[model samples]
Target: MANTKSAKKAVRQIARRTAINRQRRSKMRTFIRKVEEAISTGDQSAAKSALAAAEPILMRAAQKGIVHKNNASRKVSRLSSRVAALGKQA
Candidate 1:
């Protein structure tokens, strides 16, 4: 479909970027899932540690444009609260 040389190169670049972005998105989700799993188990220490690890990954994804800034902040806020509540329960 790309008749021009420049267009073909652009397509290749897009494909490469798409692969990289997909990897980043998958990794970010994995980190989030870890936090959720820890929360679900109601392990305060584990949940707190998982949240600490996930927070930076989420923020990095937002910084790299994988997710929105507010979206990352909202997730961090909610997870932090849940982790805190686990503490209160004990």
Candidate 2:
């Protein structure tokens, strides 16, 4: 219903931003899942490497506002713990 010109413009901007943010968030999820999958498979070295790769991507996501800082930190913390647990279990 965005009757105002400004309002309609905003809607278009939001749609474009949504697509970009969704892509960022999806990439973050993929990295996180890769780390988790490595952990699940009991590959300590691969898990460690995957966590390394995921960490920076996540931090970038936080900086870009695609993901909240605290949420990203929590995810990193939990993923780190899980990676550590994989080592312990081995």
Per lDDT, the best of the predicted structures is 1
- Judge candidate 2 at residue 70 and give its lDDT: 99
lDDT tens readout by residue for model 1, 1-90: 999999999999999999989999999999999999999999999999999999999999999999999999999999999999998998
Q: Write the per-residue lDDT of candidate 2 for residues 7-60, one digit (tens) a residue.
A: 999999999999999999999999999998998889999999999999999999
The numbered model that scores best in TM-score is 1
Screening candidate 1 with a backbone cut-off below 3 angstroms (N, C-alpha, C), the clashing residue pairs are none
**Residue 61 lDDT in model 2?**
99
Q: Provide TM-scores for the models.
A: 0.96, 0.90
Model 2 misses residue 45 by how many Å?
Answer: 0.7
Candidate 2 regions with alpha-carbon error over 4 angstroms: none
